[model samples]
Target: MRNENQGTPRRTNRFWVKVAGVGLIAGLIGGGIAIGIGGAIQHHEAVVSTRVPSGSNRAGGTKVNKNKADLNGEATRAYNSVQGAVVSVINKQNVQQDNGILGMFGPTQGDNSSSSSSNGKLETASEGSGVIYKKSGNAAYIVTNNHVVKGSSALQVIMSNGRKVDAQLVGTDAATDLAVLKINSANVTTVAGFGNSNSITAGQDVLAIGSPMGSEYANTVTKGIVSAKNRTLKAGTDGTLTSVIQTDAAINSGNSGGPLINMAGQVIGINSMKLSSDNQGSSIEGMGFAIPSNEVTRVINQIVKHGRVIRPRLGILYTDLANISAKQRQSVLKLPKNVNQGSVIMDVKPGSAAQKAGLKKYDVITKMAGQQIHGLAQLRDILYAHKIGQRISITYYQGGHVHQTTVKLVP
Candidate 1:
């Protein structure tokens, strides 16, 4: 019985050994398959990596194709085309020298400071930018911001070639903030063409070329996209509204009156002001404004033709309804509750269109030409849309009642 049991244990051990051998063979075969697959993947990757151009490495590596990374793209070309037309405008004003005690005490009441021993000398008052837009006969015309040339006894223009020449103020319009200057065309090599601002769309790429702080940085070009169109912002102390194009291009103090160019290398707008901060003193960025080229063209043409922009005038003094307190609106103006927004006429010129049309003091203008008038800005915008001698309808509230009338616009 002991011999038989020992023989049975030996058979069991043999069976277990056979099973271990099969398991070892299967593990080896599976590992070989995995190794084969990994080798094939590595080979495929190597073949693909070699397919890259001869001098260029894979994307993960540093080397790249120089042919595909050219810097002379549309923005570069556009800047090059208009760079010669950009100029720096210098405003020179007569300044009195401080003659110690004399300056401290001031010029004796009748003493002509101009004739004082310390003669008034012309010095740079401010610096801005301009664009050469036209050349006729021996003179070339430049367009710049009116504020740039304001209060200047003399104006000088620094051309792109670094040549400085005297500029004559041909015309200036304060309402539009535009001025035209005439200079000798001898050195004027380029004149920027005006593009149709009416055709410009939001998100279109644009370039701004100017001398951003002064002439030392002349021909500075900034690239950005149009952020908005037909933006109306309050301008000047009179609360006048100016329509402008908004862009993200970097514009600084000296960039005013510079050309805002499109991809076609044409001037689409004139760089004016940038909002650096809100009323709360918070910093604002990438908010630059430009006068549309269409408005620029219109104002320039009239300035060149008549030395001023002649617009149809209503000849009425008014205040925005929103400026008045709700109590004043209800008690003084007697405006209806629904009459929330409008311009309140304070006075009317005797011979003006408003007077002739029976518009009186305290009349709240609610609409003009069938368009709603939110305030003085909207009223001015709509009024300017019509030409002189054209007749338009006006809607207003008077004596707590709505009224409509047609009146002829006159200069």
Candidate 2:
């Protein structure tokens, strides 16, 4: 079950064929309604309602620095900005997994409709969250997580001002944990603003605004500093994500698709998931992660324009040459045959970008587009930053001679 980030030598690229499919399967696994957002977004009945600490209820106000800026104002502004567009997930027709250890494999939406409107499975609907991207032009696209819309085909979105309407799933990219939905509405209000994720520095204050625990507190805010930037977690695509921002703002089960904001009240990240292991609500201390806005923007534009994202491919299989002496392999990586370390390209897929650029099997690629390709780590990054038509230069070693070539990528 290991993925690309594991550093294990892959025998073939068969793993990718299974990894790339966009999949969603809904089942009967109900959860409590998440509630507690404020006047900005209005949700239906299925929201979780937990009271906040005495001075913290400024509409999902987090624990960010009070001195950094008028943070309370920033939170309120963020709240007001997306409140009307957030919605409660309606999971009445879906079946949630029974309360057991393997429950996560079942469906996830719970009773979101009025509590009194009970259907079978002792649930009505599950509560979730969303954001409206475009307004008053063509159709309003409300963005949420793919998992949220999984179990049920029918969906309902609630605005911050307290209105509910039907929403349709536009498209979802599971690799990045994001989804877009289209809703036909007249003058639908409030679209969230995008901010530069790369500009987020260490110690910069930020907030998480979403329906954690369900829609009760629609714009609930929690504050924290940008813990780190460009962190490569061994979670997906082999450090394939760049400029990924890390924060400790409290994220909960239903917080997916919510916004993480900067002092200027602009979105810098999306609150995707938190590491958790139990039903007692326990999580790793001081640990929370987000999908940087850069990745979000790229995926959104691709989905809106082409119905799916087109990630460029290098089409090569790799393995570490640990068994071979560094002295012998140095020339293999374009480094001196006497140099100390590098990975070996064991095989090249026919018709691949690598093969088309004169990269032959057993040729050790040392650099890509002038950036050092130490292992699968750096190699994945160089190819990821470009699109299908972009060109790049490659440096490799063969026959004790260093050589270079250029490659044009393909989707």
Candidate 3:
């Protein structure tokens, strides 16, 4: 011991250590260490590693700007995730075909004559983006849009490292504009997780990854912001309002069914449609929408179980009841129990849940599940809360007497 308890030497050593720690932190704040930190943190990639991947930077190198780091991270996550989920998709699309009946007119619809190099046997192939939700028995069930792989059932997935595999159709739901697919392949790479759409705030950064007019470029990335939320747009193909996650991300024709990812690489929505002048009135730009992931999970669960998402209809027309003759009553004006309140049962669908439950014309619903019936929106919200097969208790005013009934839901 060289003065083991000496205060002078101990103080000097402690001062140097603090200085070093501060220096390291400062370097990470705005120096090249940030890229390294990002790589490490993502890898936890937060701890330590002997090997650094191609896209990752080294530790204590530099710091990236807040915005830049966020953008870079989002793009990287999307590209990696997209590539991983794309497995074997390219293999299905890029095969050379023969000169057909119209010779130079190209292969006719539903032609699969180019998958083999040795013999003239027909093997099927098609190009589309597939999202991995879960690993089913001997296969992975991926989801995509119907139109992408509609005609031919043959599905292909391309992996991050360029490996390919053939996929199958799981199920489809046309009403909700969603489809589920499955594929069997070894070494399958990624499964995109669902992000909470309800937690999304406006102005948050977002990224869209898709092929878009070029199926070969399967993992192309575009940047944007959460322009709005809970936006109700239309998908003309299905007469229902597409409850969507509106963003400034550029979504083109072929981008449908791709994911809208956040900086953390979590998918918040499914890229569904882009608002074009043809879809709207005037020139619409920077407006794109995605199906909320919450809705996606629900529809997927239904399709996987029942081959369709069963939505029970509560038979009644809102217009049947008269509201207080105020224009705003439909929106802002509150409803009273005996006045502009619940929908009057006008005409019930034959053998519908309402009809079976003894609901009749002019019957006024006063409350639902003990919640006051403000109007149709409130009623719709309450009803939507119940799944098909769930029983509901509703109170209504009819025959000058208050009565309640339990109704079983059906899709």
Candidate 4:
């Protein structure tokens, strides 16, 4: 019985060994098939896909192109804000026409055909720029240079949207070179905002918007920086000193009365004029001036309220004492040796404040209103500060003797 049991165990062990060998062969085949399939899939992917560096651009990528957003910067913001408020001012005058009647030698005066249509007046046109600063009820106020509307038989304002409307001259102040006009506010889209010129400093960014050469270039924008905070520029050969804000922005002939825009999208200045050439006939560039918004607000308000700027007038035609030769000073007017800079009274109008105060021709005004007067500009600066009918003291030199008198200012 023991011998039979031992033989049965040997038989069982032999059967299990054969089963293990068959299982090992089948497992190896299955593993090889799985590895081959993975390699084929990976090879297919490598062949079909395109590879690129990490930072490289793709055909359809998610990056922003800043150049395409050129109109999204501060300059664009400022221009966009005020461009709509700017308009072209046209000055139409009835000039005499030149018909050359009876040939060129007929009459010295040209025939009035060109200027005169049927009623014998031909229309001549001049242009500048202006800003719509205020809108009240059915009327909108536009501010421009006084010289622009000077001698205009008719005035027209061309809006940004190409609408032309008649403009009535509200008031004009030649001393400040500012004029106010009114137009129907029917299609007014935007009214420009004002900024405190006192808050802006030199070297700040600025933009000029205007009809540079006419309505053809209306709303043309030029960029620059504030070259100076305050510049005293003479206007109209009168040597009338006007305090202005100097900028490097390009201001052309037709740019006068347009707005000088700041980065905050506010009008800080009014483009007044630019230096065209020096006395030596040298071309000048990058020198442009504007009326400061603070002064503009002050002057325009008075112009709007009154038909003119009611300045306290002493009514004396004077020249700067510095312009007089030292010989003339010591010989004609006989001013004191110590007195050099002041306004020399040339002609005081009859019944004027100066004349009423006993001032006469050749009287050198040394001081006014307790302030030292160096020249006509300084005297005007001080004189305009007082109201009409106010009593002010004046000091003068007559025949090398100093005298004092009180004068009542008048408009």
Candidate 5:
């Protein structure tokens, strides 16, 4: 019952997948309600809210009776309150694909060089959703999933009012799958505020607002209840997301980076990825997950100020011994009969904290900073709790013997 990160090699079919798109068209247009934004943008300052005129209807002239809608009462209210802050994020990138053995065996009859398999250059675009979380002077800040803007040659932010503006990548943190983008504040309207993610409970009504699919469905709203809380998911080969919020609010591919709002009209989470199916290949529904807003704020603040989030690194590359076969463990690493799990260090960087502490290849880290470690995830979690240049104790096993040493962390 081990969880795996999206696109991990070990769990090829059982892995998670990021919510993004491929082969997307360019210059897609959309229609949605407009909310006007005014005044100067300021850091950490709440954006001014302007109420829609009474009797005003959506672009299609459909009137929504806020009080009598069949939808969840609190969800409807939350959606209407925060919809104006949801945005569409567009990414453009150059994609190149090379034809392999098949190309060498066929399709060489064409005499023209322009239509050959060698030229695999293509134009690719993708769309995801984002939220306007802050404004400072002429700039506004957007928080989105890192996968949304990962390989962008250019980025654009489409406001809830249908106005599209160029956005600059402020900073990105891959370990957390979050990114911050900045754009001109002129068209910025409603900025969503954060709620206490720690207070969210299962079965509470929630709303998801985003462009689910593309601008064609911009600001689409879905309603559901919080399915679960503090669900752990793999982040990468060596990292795990310890506290993601789970919801059943129909989070699709384009919904990545969008806001998950609570009844109080505050953002509780950022939709990131969804579980599609079991290893047996059955369809899985109502299993979407999001990054808690509290964690989002912590990473966003660091990214906004530093252009990157800095964390202490132990400067070692290793594989989880748990993933290795028992035969290999017994034959190669030569651990004691009772030893079952640990992180086997493969390489320690020269002059690194591990190297300075006399850690070497094949040394299995069994504990760190007083916490027992089973694999990389636990070790990473424990190591990251300490700040840069802080000293911590490490316990490891080498040549069937246990040893402990104190090492100072570095960026």
Candidate 6:
């Protein structure tokens, strides 16, 4: 029960499997084995609300009829508006066949050979959810979590009506855990709209639409309130800081890349990961997070235009100073007695920003752009905050002496 990212691992015989590791955050990607349902596209109109008139009470106060009141009001409308646009994403990978002597001998009598061994076939590696965001020129674009389609040989999209279509990988940004996909727009009748995530306040109603536990539960909708805004979490293996919207919605395995919609039926966030437990192995609940739609729009635009995200690079590998022993800091790095935290440059890329700035190996970086750099992660977080070609100040200790220099960031 250590801190781990959660993605549903592949299971056989309709069983559910969980992936575990040392991280509290769990990506809602389902890797379970499932059967795809085939059918034609079926369109569903948004539900209309019915109004009931209020009656006068004996005390002269207006009394509304409880029995005739619309219980499925905003939530129902919000869900219906985007339900058709939500889809199930399938990640298929090429199953490797055993090349050993036993595998080459083939299955003997009474032996059950794997279906993937019969031919060079692909198998379902994982499943998640996605939202159809845009349609243009016979192609529809989808947005989902990068982990949902990571290491995939091929990807498929299961529409709301159970229609399956091949999806092309447009681009993926692992730092943000977001990916863009392209599919045929012929059967895509609905396109979810983006809302102003920056303006969404805490306690505002929201809806989450996606497949939970695979295509078998596709188009599932859950209601919740915006628990908090601007919640930051350390994402990816590199510990990149990512800001996301926190909610109490029921985002489960297979809901990754799905849309978190507002009461107005506009997508405010893209469901990504959740905190499943504490570092001490205590189970926690109601702590799901989604990528703010504003960031998603920015990243996807660049991905669609460039097939990749272009970010400023420091062109140097470094280790966190906190990870080094005090003896190593003084003996190997030759740092001052008070200097305990920084990034120790390991290698500088040739003809790159660090090299151009006269930075060398063993330089301990203490500050960047006037901000204190405690470790590599903090340095990276500050570095990524600037744009490419921007000049920034860098402070480091060289030969036990402190010095400051300006370096222009490059892409």
The TM-score leader among the candidates is 1
Q: Per-residue lDDT of 22-123 in model 4, one digit per residue for the tens?
A: 889889998999999999999988977866535744576677656765667988878888889999999988865544455556634444335334444636
lDDT digits (tens) for residues 316-357 of candidate 5: 988888876778676777778788878999888998889999
220-298: candidate 1 lDDT, tens digit per residue: 9999999998788854324568778999999999999999999989999999889999999999999999989988998
Q: List the residue pairs that clash in candidate 6.
A: 3-22, 3-23, 4-23, 4-24, 6-26
Once fitted onto the true fold, the runs of candidate 2 whose alpha carbons sit more than 4 angstroms away are: 1-75, 82-127, 136-138, 234-243, 277-283, 319-346, 360-364, 373-378, 398-401
Ranking by lDDT: 1, 4, 6, 5, 3, 2
User: Global CA lDDT of candidate 5, please?
Assistant: 0.83
Model-by-model lDDT, in order?
0.90, 0.68, 0.69, 0.88, 0.83, 0.86
Off by over 4 Å in 1: 1-67, 99-120, 237-239, 323-341
Q: Alpha-carbon error at 231 in model 1, in Å?
A: 2.9
lDDT of 6 by residue, 229-313 (tens): 9786865434667778999999999999999999999999999988889999999899999998988888898899999989899
TM-score of each: 0.75, 0.65, 0.63, 0.71, 0.67, 0.66
Give the per-residue lDDT of model 3 (tens digit) for 1-411: 587667888899999999999998887776767787777678764444656556655466776756644655546755665546643232133344444344476544446544334333334454555567677667777777765665553566665565666666767777557888777745665777878988999999998877676466767778999999777555425555456788998887667777888887777887877878864478888999887787788878888888866776777664425553544333333334445566666667888889899887667787887888765545655676678788888998666567899889887
**Model 4: lDDT of residue 132:** 98
Off by over 4 Å in 6: 1-67, 97-118, 196-203, 230-234, 237-241, 317-351, 358-382, 385-387, 392-405
Q: Which of the numbered candidates is closest to the native, going by highest lDDT?
A: 1
Q: How far off is model 2, as Cα RMSD?
A: 33.1
How far does residue 184 in candidate 3 sit from its true spot (Å)? 1.1
Q: Give the per-residue Cα lDDT of candidate 4 at 49.
A: 80
**lDDT score, candidate 6, position 191:** 96
Which runs in model 3 stand beyond 4 Å of their true positions? Answer: 1-83, 86-127, 278-281, 316-346, 361-384, 395-405
Best first by TM-score, ranked: 1, 4, 5, 6, 2, 3
Model 5 scores a TM of 0.67
lDDT of 4: 0.88
